[model samples]
Target: MNGGTDLLGVVSSLLGPGGGSAVDPVEAAARVAWSALVEPGDAVGGLLVQGLGAERSFALVRAAVDDGPELLVESCRDAGLPGAESPSVLTGAVAEALARWGPRLGRVDVLAALDAARAVGARLLVPGAAGWPRAVDDLGPHAPIVLWTRTGRRADGPAVAVVGSRANTVAGAEATAEITSVAADRGCTVVSGGAYGIDATAHRVAVAAGTPTLAVLAGGIDQLYPAGNFELLRNVARQGALLAESPPGTRPTRWRFLARNRLIAALGAATVVVEAGARSGALNTAHHAAQLGRSVFAVPGAFSSSASVGCHRLVAEGRAQIVVHPEDPVDTVLGRSRHATPGRGRSSSSGTPVLAGREDPEVLRVLDALGRRALGEQELAARSGMSFAEVADALALAELQGLVVHGVGGWTRA
Candidate 1:
């Protein structure tokens, strides 16, 4: 097995102390190599690297692989890493890992990656490095092996994530841009997974507002995904920052996209899901944010829209608070003040206007029919001039947002 000697030499030459960096060359090279060695968000790889130093762990894995799959499984069991304590259970896992990682081991070139990053003025960032975002530490064992960063500047305050569906609506995109701009202007950095729709809108607005926005990518920084956003990502790299855990030459895969969500969630002080379906990847980021003890916010969408289902679910279940306006995150991070810009209106849907820049035309009509009295679904549908089916869907969403409630009598405005 290749011990990555040539890879180390290349990294050493590229990461010399010319920039006044005191980081060890060997360690940097090992991190770059390790990033290529395992997939992003590999908890076992993180555990191994943290338990043993990256270089030592790299050597151990290499030696074990060279010793063959059986020996590798034995070594893993002896090391007592999670999922490996049971020798029988670990054997298959080790063999599978060997199959996945072995063929690519000889192909990684840390030098090429470093050179590619340098060509674009990006730097390879490891833990403990200056400008590293400490918030990512919240990921614990699932933390990234290395980060490729464009901007050398780190946020002076907490970063907030703005995420949502790629097929977002105009209102959702507008909300993301507006919210991100407000937060950035209020001294927060905007972090996102750098997909289209909401992610693109957030980054553009933040940059235009002169707020530092971080684009957390699934693929290599050198290989920006969604080819359509190439220029936009380049602008982000130049003006704000572009970050990726994957090394150069790595393509964005479905698994990588899912794994990258954790980084976006962990890097933020809070996560705001602008719009998401029940199965949206933005929800995944929200889940990670909640797990890390970060506040999760969801922007309410029109009740009839599928895009808003996840956000409504989050709000109704108390998993997240409703963000009616852009300044909610700013208030959470910088502390609420009388002088702070007003949010959509109230924190909860109770006693708050239903169509406050949220409800669609149909939803507005249905809400207007509710008035101040209780009405059955059929009666409300007739009064609102909407179909019964439409009324039912709208009421479900309104109830979830706490805008309306059902009781012994029927439905009433909350």
Candidate 2:
């Protein structure tokens, strides 16, 4: 038998034991076969064909074959070249499994796939890659095994995760936009799952601001989860990166959504829950951020609104900092203000001044309103009277300035 098939058989045998502790040998073999068969910078199609199962393998092979033998021929051409073939096969195998199972597999399967993928890639970044974010890993082991990425021409930078409910209030949408703009001005990349409400707002604002933003897909990178966000996803990929743990052609699943949250948390220096109910998925993301040791922030809402409950609870439990304004630049809330501080008169080319002991005036106003008590935006606005737009603009400025901090419920002085 060809070494590829032999490897698959081996991994299959290991997996056949069907016990909690048993490692699937077939999977291990698949990992080996994948590493042998594919190369870095090679077309993804050829890799899929060489590593996938019988039924799926042939289909993918056919697609690549039909596209003309360029990719397949290249794979064979580069097979023995140095740096072309990776030392570990585990990553390819795990990535294949993630693609195959889609969202059906349990936490064990996901972890195994991630482990294998990282082993093979030799760049196993979890929530702690130098850029490993504590926010996403807080999801615990349910976190993604690897973040398959291909950076762009621009420098890789910090990102903020903006997430909220699908059926969100107008206020929520506005908040997302304001917060995203602030992040962009601070030279931070905005990360989101590309969902509705807050996620959409965050992306749109980032794009409009001419800043880089990334979208973490719960499904395949080839397909956008929400059909409506297809254009937005494309824009993000062009400006920044679109990431996925699973290979192409996978569909979104409930468990994947929960798992996907970790990516947003992990990628972002800090996580902001824009608007979520007690049971909202955004709250789940906040929990993961806490677990990962990332700073958590929240935007407070109306006391009577169900959407505000999650943020309120997070603040009460000390799980999140309350953000009253988007511009408050304290690291305690967004976890990024520390990096934004000026270093000996050096200013980032972006023109946004680094924090240097000075504070944003808008953040000061919001803090004065919070005064050791969590206050919703409406109350803060009523007390400050600065129009909603003015308040939002100030908050966004303050957040970037590191003068104030935001959390689950509202904003406070740092």
State which candidate has the highest lDDT.
1
How many pairs of residues in model 2 come into backbone collision? 46
Compared with the true structure, model 2 gives a TM-score of 0.51
After superposition, which runs of candidate 2 have C-alpha atoms over 4 Å from their true positions? 1-143, 150-155, 329-414
**Predictions in order: lDDT:** 0.73, 0.55
Model 1 residue runs over 4 Å out of place are 1-21, 69-93, 335-414
Candidate 1, residues 153-200, lDDT tens digits: the string is 555666788999888999998898788878877878888877888998
Global Cα lDDT for candidate 2: 0.55
What TM-score goes with each of the models?
0.74, 0.51
lDDT of 2 by residue, 1-414 (tens): 123554444333323234212333333333333322322112242234333432344333334433643453344334532213542332332233334333332222323443443342222222222333344443332344334442342426666778877778999888888888788877888888888778888888888888988787776555576999888877776777677665444577654666577667776667888878755778656655554556678887898988777777666656677886786422433344455432121112222222322355665566566667444455678988667666665554444333444432345554
Write down the worst ten-residue block by lDDT for model 2: 342-351
